[model samples]
Target: MPELVGTDEDDYLTLNYNGFVPLLTKAMQEQQTEIENQQKEIDELKAQLEMIMKMMQSDMSDKTDNKKAENNQKPVKLSMATVK
Candidate 1:
């Protein structure tokens, strides 16, 4: 089995600075960036959902107001005509 420890000269440079493997550190940074991008997408989707919900609520209120207007209107009466 290959040794778990990476002892290449490039690894040595970073290992001396912060004890992190260069390859692994770069991969970690990339993953962090991806997470940040996904978080932004999630925030945008949440905003859209909120806007949709508000539109639905507004539609419901408008329908209710229309119904109330219909109910409050005066009823019409028709007069029967007599044939001569």
Candidate 2:
């Protein structure tokens, strides 16, 4: 139980442990908000990274296809000689 510890005679002011609750509650709520915002930012960055990876994979595949097509155009020559 919170008990009033003292009072100012001139101003008629009283202080107690119960007064701390509102401040503590506000601080806790702010911390929760901060944690949520950070989580949201982290998720967005992950999504962006995934997109970049997909684009790189697509570009690599196209380059591989081009290389295969070029290789197909080249001809192979083999020469053999017999001496007696």
Largest TM-score belongs to which candidate? 2
By summed lDDT, the worst window of 10 consecutive residues in model 2 runs over 75-84
TM-score of 2: 0.71
Q: Give per-model TM-scores.
A: 0.64, 0.71
Q: Taking the tens digit of each residue's C-alpha lDDT, what string does model 1 give over 2-57?
A: 33445676666222444447767998999999999999999999999999999999
Candidate 2 residue 59 Cα shift, in angstroms, is 0.9
Cα lDDT tens digits for candidate 2, 4-55: 5566878765788787898789999999999999999999999999999999
True-structure lDDT of candidate 1: 0.80
Clashing pairs in 2: none
Reference-based lDDT, residue 30, model 1: 100
Report lDDT (CA) for all predictions: 0.80, 0.87
Candidate 2 stretches with Cα past 4 Å from truth are 1-15, 81-84
